[model samples]
Target: MHQTSSRLLRMTDDERPFTRSYIWPQYALLFAYPHRTSLFISDPNNSCDFKDLFSTLMVSLPLTPHRVRFRMIDFTFTSDEAITNLGSLKFSQSNRMPDPKDSSRVVTTTTTTTFSMAKEMARSVCQKFFEAKFIESVESKIDFQNKNSVWQLTPKGIHILERFCSRNGIQSAHVKAVIDSSRNPRQLVILERDIDTDKLHHDEQTVEIIFRRFVGATVNESLSADSDSIHEFSRSDVGVRMIKHKPSNARPYEHVFTGKATVDWLMDCCTMVDRREGLEIGQLFLDLRLITPVDARAPGNDTKFVPTKQAQYYVTVHGQQIAGWTEFDDSPIPADPNSGKSREGAARDSNSNRTNVIIRNPSWRLLYREFLKDTMCEENLSFYLEVQEFRAQYTAAVSITGDHKIETIRETLAAAYGLYNAFLAPGSPNELNIDHALRTQLATRMTRAVGDDTAMMQSLVEVALLFEKAQNSIFKLMSSDSVPKFIKHPKYGPQLRGLDAAAAAAYVANSNMSSSRSS
Candidate 1:
């Protein structure tokens, strides 16, 4: 939205058309992609800007650290064999002496230094040829484990040895020294401090600086441990260590609509956002209380908790592992296109690419009533998870049903999708703004009022019970004093006792009426 300038032809920076026909929306939409966005239409009157939406997603982006280090060589070959051709390592050219009786005989001297160099050269050559698999590169180091004979890296890595340092409001070069030592550590996997810390600003340690120091030159290319090198890392001000990194992460809102936290860390960092053309961002907020179903036993037979997918995530963002992203994509650093299809395709590709498939351990979700707080959560959470449930009901409502309770589920799935931001969140992305709640409610009410009546019980018994509990909620708006007063004429009350069933029927009828009025 633009405020018409009093000066007609006057132009401000935001509205200036960079391209011949393009105009930048003043407020860019920050979308929390992977969100069910069709919900925005629940209240058709509530218009939001198309530009304010944004999706910050965790992409498990691949990384290929420029430097690499190995602690224990896993090959069956001996260390000697590992360095066989690097230099004439096994050959020694030292002077040999005969017995005293043969002292007069000539003494011969052999050259060992040249042999050692030759062997070293051979080792380098062999590594390039056969171990090329280990030479994978990345934008950053990756973390992984192995049973034996294998080393792995992940996008989940930290930079080492060549850290940047700053102190007293001024950045220093010393941090670089720390980084250098680590990059070429003498020992493949030495403790962080053991490498070198001599010249660091003796007293200060900020997380940013610490992060760099810890991640810097740790690779085993060349242990750059030198007194001069130690002197290179700069120090920091006095109170640095106490500072903790404020992860620029949003909660994983995949559960904005349903699910016990399948992945806890992810949900807490979820953020909600939106973006569209021609409008200013009107709303963006965390549902701090986005609802999902609780753990329950099987209806009759099972005792162990089996969490329902209701009120759980309606959508999810899939990504590759950080360490293997590059091996999968052949690129050390990955880019985010914010295209839901692309990211999902990448994930499917990578998952299918695995030669060994491993199923992760499963954990249980505790009873929601016992562990969670929202009183009406059960009422608000999703109950019907399948589209078939609505088969005989409203077609529009049935279109969005899913087998899995996800971050979102609604009637406009075909036109809506998730977006992912690469930098902020690692696994889950922020979401776009959509009036999911309002729209869902409207759909629920509409379906009950006009479509199939039986499915209403499957969907909204909880709501009916709530009304029963707080009878005042039902009568409060019906009082004669309220506008559009309930004309309680003698004819209106005939056989009109507010039985639960009758009330349910009336609500359905009214809901249909309202939906039609709006349309």
Candidate 2:
């Protein structure tokens, strides 16, 4: 390769300019450090001649091993009129006095200038280069209204190059900070994005989550009390609508009624949909009471049935199975027993299919329990049963839709249970077992119920204190290993306390306590 500058001449081992015959896999370095924030642009004051800019870029390339190869090159040139109107690029000049050893005595001066280009136009140029392989494929784009074109590198390209460079020990200090920052994981906050359309219905269900954000440290106050005195809260702030993507929400909710098989198979059995596997699941929700067709079946009415709202769940056989529908006439449809079609044409009417069974606010306890049951085994049998019972009682006591303090307590308890079982449990699974719908619902509900950070923290602290008290009380009786064993033994008990120490020792010896303990 011919070098026009000394910088280009100092290329390390396999580093070379873009060439048709260059072996990309064999080379362990890239042209620039690829990042989302940084972009390459030409000097605004310079002429738009592509050849001159390209040459300058090669010569000015920082002495650093790049983690990502150049994806595309952008050449942006402002019109003469625009340049004249915007004025010459902003610049600064520095003067250097001539030294005594210099014979020519010419004062050296240097200029630094900031360039401006139309970013959209630059992106277009980069796109063309990417398509032609003049550079690599297009990774991403940055939208800017100002006059500047930027060509950014792709993350995959950067990662591949980084791994290659690491293997070769070609570390570059210039890109070290960028690499480290990119490697660090980001803090996650629970949020929901609202959408007006059911565009993603095929992929997953969209569930609404309700939560409140506070402006200050009154989170505890907000959570403990009502949010009536608004701090500029909006309907948007109250809740966010999020789509529950598949498999994440598609984990089979196990039920004894669904037989020993998964809820997926049970759904298949119930629905005639083309993709029957997970199709019916969207229509089937957890009913805590294990309400059957007989339980819900009306005495004289054959077509319409409305059981007690307590512990109820609604799953639609058609459309998205969420709430928000016009109230249906609870009375049975007047139908001919022979034909089974309604005389009022209600069966044919689209409105007749609407039912009240779909609950807008499902029991949080049941929803979480059914979801978590997928990960449990015999070891957590007691916990599983406790969750099942807790859900049943919770649904029976609380209305489906309301902002009662009791509801907030239920949400907090559910979150606490999830944290303990899925996160803090011994031999717990590493990944979060929660589905998108449940997460969105629970997060919003808890946020709304608690009020703010301080309120939520206070609620959690109270729960923790209660749990600690309960644990101390329960363990007091069985805290020592020897006490419970002695109480249970038929030969020793409270009655033995009245006997002398000699008699107790004799009894212990006769019962073969040492042998029993060893066994």
Candidate 3:
């Protein structure tokens, strides 16, 4: 809590001589009427938990201290007017109201009571502000026109309110509500400390950052820890040790985390944040009520503090450990394209020219060309062109290695059928116009562009052979005498009539089986 000065303002002539009757009327009228600022206060204690809204304000607020002041005016309505207004207003507690039929009793007492009630309410607000240490002091002055005492924020109070308003991106009206203790904190606490970058260490105290962008849309609740608990994608080699914690509070840690080896491996994928830093981040989140302790009976249940795919997060430690973000934007550093690869003079064995040619060819472009006359269609052609361009761009940019190369070749094979299907479509294009010679040309260019990777080369050759076999089977079936029946019949209709129903089925089955085995 921040320390504040205790300089009290002396009451003015009109403000003095306060009594229970004067306070009750004011309190009742204020309570009975609704104010926009009051909506921000969910609890009477002036403590709040506004959820994500509060977090947003904390992040966007300016750190530099500043000051702002506003003069509070007396209630627009007179005591009698407030009492009269209260007749039509609702009260939470019916007992707070007096009999309306007794006009004499109401006139003599209710006017002071209404004003007094409002005064008490203001005093309560002042008390809340003092408790929260939100103000240095409050002052009062007589309004020259009305001789009514008005409250105002002292310099310290103004500075604090201004800072809060700036950080929260709220207007002066909202700031006034906060100063009056009409608004509470949305969360348990808002941590404004600057994260220390010196605490960062790699390897032992760090984890390799791994970022994944999902292909489709995702929701906050669906990506939450409760939906799918965080765990390592792979196991670690490090030996296990007993976790140091008491039994009653240990189940959550035990259930959420895995073995030491696996934990290390999982952490390796996260950006490095040491244990001490992790503790600080965790404490901040805990104080803000972002995360609560896991229940003993139902572990890994709903979590407010856990970072879902929806929330930005820094690398964490242990189970649900929070830590500093890698960058100001909170984005993870991308994995280097050259990571783990031999750079400059590092020795790497060379493959034969023959294998090199196959890699460059990938031969999938050849396969696409071969099947183009049989399958080209708008959708197929569009996708085929996109994949082709992507592969070309990727090959030209980097030295092919590991999964990157393998994935490219895999994509080639995956979309290879589109060309075949397009060529065989109802309004098929001319087969003669499509060049067959480009197969070798495409393979050569691709191989040169992709450079060399053993796994990628092998995958390319394998898929090429399969594509070749497919084209051959397709051509053979199209040219055979059985083709006339295939052409005469509807797409899904009968063919190979020499054999009866059973024989035809058996023959077709055998052909498919042979084709599958060959591929």
Residue-level lDDT of model 2, residues 1-519, one tens digit each, is 000101111111222111111111110001111111222222121112221222222222232222324533332122222223222222222323222234245333232322344544434433332322122212233322223333322222233233323322234454343334442111111111111110112212211110111111111111212111111111111211111222224332211111111121221121111122222322322221111222234472222222222211222222111222223334643433533222233333211111111111122211222222333321122222333333443344343445445444434344343333232222233222334444433333322334443455465555444334333332332223222343344532322221222233333343466579889
Please report the candidate that would top lDDT against the real structure.
3
Task: List candidate 2 stretches off by more than 4 Å.
Answer: 1-125, 128-158, 167-169, 183-519
Misplaced by over 4 Å in model 3 are: 1-118, 127-321, 324-332, 335-519
Q: Is candidate 1 or candidate 2 better by TM-score?
A: 2
Provide the RMSD of all predictions against the true structure, rounded to 1 decimal: 33.2, 30.2, 32.3
TM for candidate 3 is 0.16
So what's the TM-score on candidate 2? Answer: 0.16
Local accuracy by lDDT, each model: 0.21, 0.26, 0.27
- Cα lDDT tens digits, model 3, 1-519, are 011111111222233211100001111122112221121111111121111111122222222222224543321222222222322222121111122333223211111111112444434433333222222222222221221222233222333444334322234443444444522222111111111112322221112111110000111122122222222121112211122332353442222222222222222221121223333443343344323444423443333233332332221232122111122333544543542232211212111111122112222122222233234322232222333433443343344566545544433432232232223212222121223444333223222222334544554454345344434434333333222332344521221111122223333454568789999
TM-score of each: 0.13, 0.16, 0.16
- Weakest lDDT window of 10 consecutive positions for candidate 3: 17-26
Which lDDT tens digits does candidate 1 get at residues 1-519?
111100011112342211110111111111112121122222211111111100000001111112224433211222233343233322121222222235345333232211123554444433332221121122121221111122221111112111101100112233233223333221111111100111111112111222222223221112221122211212211110111222334544222221222211111111101011101100000121111122223362122211222322211121111111112333433333443443344343332211011001000001111111122221110111111122222233434345522212222121111111110111212111224453334223322221233333333333333223222321222221211111132322211122223233334454568789999
